[model samples]
Structure formats: structure tokens, C-alpha cells
Target: MRQKEIQLNSDELRSYIDSVGYEKDNLLEQLRKETQDLGDESIMQVGSSQGKLLEIICRIGNFNKCIELGVFTGYSSICIAKGINDEGRLFAIDISEKYTSIAKKYWEKSGLDHKITLILDEAINVLDTFIDDGLKGTFDFIFIDADKSNYIEYYKKSFDLIRSGGIIAIDNTIWKGKVFDNDDQTQSTKTIRDLNMLISNDPMVSQCIITMYDGMTLCLKK
Candidate 1:
């Protein structure tokens, strides 16, 4: 294949298709637009375009089980739930009942309310409970976009919950490029940078730090 052709992204390909008056072009574009409107403005919220790509990946994986460490306003949850849900189950943990109720509306609207199981509590506590209940290596996918300070803790728990050949994605792992910036040595950046190095050298999974919206470390469990 030619270099230019190989360089085209999913978005560029979609745009090219729309230019040719493809039948599904309008609907696809609309989906992109609408998702952004409902999504929150938090640093934690993955953008609509990226979220759409992730949702499609989850759908195609047909993963039966997923665990999400954070459910900030439910944008990412909605994206993941839309993908894998005939017999699938999503275990999402977050402490905010108020934010979750807002996400509940979208889940019901998408008719994916049953696909997700929202747990309102601390992540460490919930994960420990899952471990105690013999849920080791049960999940096919796990996403960690929560408290940055406890990233390593989440990584360890996710490693145990995810089955072999499963994928684990950690958001803000690059900390908006701040991990490399030595402007501050505060605990947050230090923790993230420390984990970045730690995971790079971890033997349990092969990691790729993709330079997406933020730096996303996508790990495939070995």
C-alpha cells in the first residue's frame, strides 16, 4: 500500500467516505456530534471521537465481562456499555451517587442499563471484595481512569481480575505529558511518572503508551 493511503486514520477514512455520499455517513457523523454534547468537561472524560473508537473496539471484542475503576459522569461507561452487552456485564465503581444518576439517564436511553452494574464505594474496598469472592481473572477488559494517586494499586487489582489475553487501558497515564515535564515534583506527577516506568518494565503484560487524547497505556495481559 502507498504511504499516504496507509497514513489515513479512521476519522479521515470516514470523512473520505462521507465525501462520496456514503449511505451511513450522516448517521455516523451525527453519533459523533451527539456524544460530545452529552459528555462532561472533566479532565477524566475521554473525548467523543476517542470514546467512539473505544466503544467500537469493545463491541467487536464481544467481551463478556468488563471492569471500570472510575465512572465520572458516566461518559466512558456509556461508551463501553454500548459495545459489549448481549450477555456481557460491566462492573463500575464510583463513590458519587449524584453523578451516577445522571449517567443512569443515558444508560436507560441507550437501553443498555442492564449491561452495567454500578457499585457505589471506594475502588480498593470493592476490588478486595471481588478478590475475596473468587473473581480472579474474570474480566475481559478493565479501564482505569480514576484517582491518579492510586494508579499502581488499580493496576495490580486489574491485573488479577483480567483474564489472559485481555486488555487493560489506563487513562491519564502520561498525565497530559506532565509526566515528562519536570516543572513540578509534587506527589501526583511523581506517582504517575513512577508507574509509567514501573509498568514499562512490568513482566506480567506488554504495554504500549499510545499518544492519544491523553497518554493511554494499553496493556495486553500475557
Candidate 2:
């Protein structure tokens, strides 16, 4: 039997679902709200629904060693950490120390600080270091959420670092629905479109882009 389809097209309905279906722990919830209160930068933080989904994915995959590009206040990091095994660790890379400071506070508050290592440097450079250190195909999960222009490159690096059965979740593929607008030839949009196409055609992995928050493309390494 087909399951009933429910739509949360309205803001009110979506908000209700966000509050009810994925009520984050108090510390995480506060960090999310506080980040949003910071204005446009708040969009950098993934939605509560997306955060919850990441956690669920981690738990289901038994994903322990992980990498997250773009720590943005650490909201997603905390979610990922929550679902990981107690001994699991996440290497979070971001360019801004200012923003990660906030994440640090919340991680400490959540008692998850020890589980995450925040790297203050260029994401690509960090990925290069991982490869230099001979750490390929070792990560159980990898999340790419930074520098839209380098998304394809990030995906490529992630592909090499992720284990055969591991998963790579790339956020912001839809580009606020700009991928469908041909006139919008912004580099970010163009790069995202290219990355989506590359992932679609690549035989090394099977993937699907889910319509959630901005859009998350979940890829399973084969």
C-alpha cells in the first residue's frame, strides 16, 4: 500500500512540523535560535529538520569517523555528534574562528566538545592534508556545506576520503531553486549545477538530491 502523502507547503505548517517532529535538545535548540537571530548569516546553519535528518543518518549508518566542511556555529556538528558513537570523532573545518567560537561554547555545554575537532583553515586545504596524511577511504561519513563554488572539488575529495560504503551528504544543491533559472549564471549556481550533474553521471556512487531545507544530495560510495 502507498503511504499517504502529507504536504507542509505553508510556513505555519512547516514551522509546526519543525517544532514537533524534531525538537532539538535545549542546548542545540538555543544555539540554532541564537544563530538565526544573527541575521543573514543564520542561513548558513542548516534547518532543524535537516539537522535531525543528519543525526538520523549517522545513527542508521553507525557512522563514527566523520568530516564536516563548514561548521557555521556548529549546529550541524552538534547534531552529527549526538548521533555518533561515544568514541566517534568529527573533524569540522571552517574558515571563520569567530563563528566557530560560538559552536565551541555550545559543544562544551552539550559535553560533546571532546568529540569534535574544529579546524580553522581553508576547507580544501584541510582535505588535501587528509590525503597527504594517507587518510583516504577512511571516513564513515562526510558532510560538505561550504563554499558553493568549490562544491564539485569538495565532492571529489570527499569521494576519496569516504569508505566504500560510507555516505557523503552535500548541502545546498538547489541553490534556493536557482539551479532551474537559466538566466542566473552566478558562479555559485553554475558550480552547484555542475556538481549535481557530475554526481548524477558518476558511476562510482549512487545518489539522490532530497528536497529539504535548501536541498541535500545524499551519495553512497560504491
> Alpha carbon lDDT of residue 213, candidate 2?
72
lDDT of 1 by residue, 1-222 (tens): 655544323577546644652223233344345545655644456655556655776877777799888886677787788778688888988988866776676677667889989999999998889999999998899988888889889989889989998889898876766899998698889989988888888898988987656667888899
The parts of candidate 2 lying over 4 Å away from their true place are 1-9
Tens digits of per-residue lDDT, candidate 2, 83-188, equal 8999999999999988999999999999988899999999999999999999999999999999898998999999999999999999999888899899999999
Task: Name the runs in model 1 displaced over 4 angstroms.
Answer: 1-41
Candidate 2 has a TM-score of 0.94
Supply every candidate's count of residue pairs whose N, Cα or C atoms clash at under 3 angstroms: 0, 0
* lDDT minimum window of 10 residues, candidate 2: 4-13
lDDT of candidates 1 onward, in order: 0.78, 0.91
Q: What is the RMSD, in Å, between candidate 2 and the native fold over all Cα?
A: 2.5
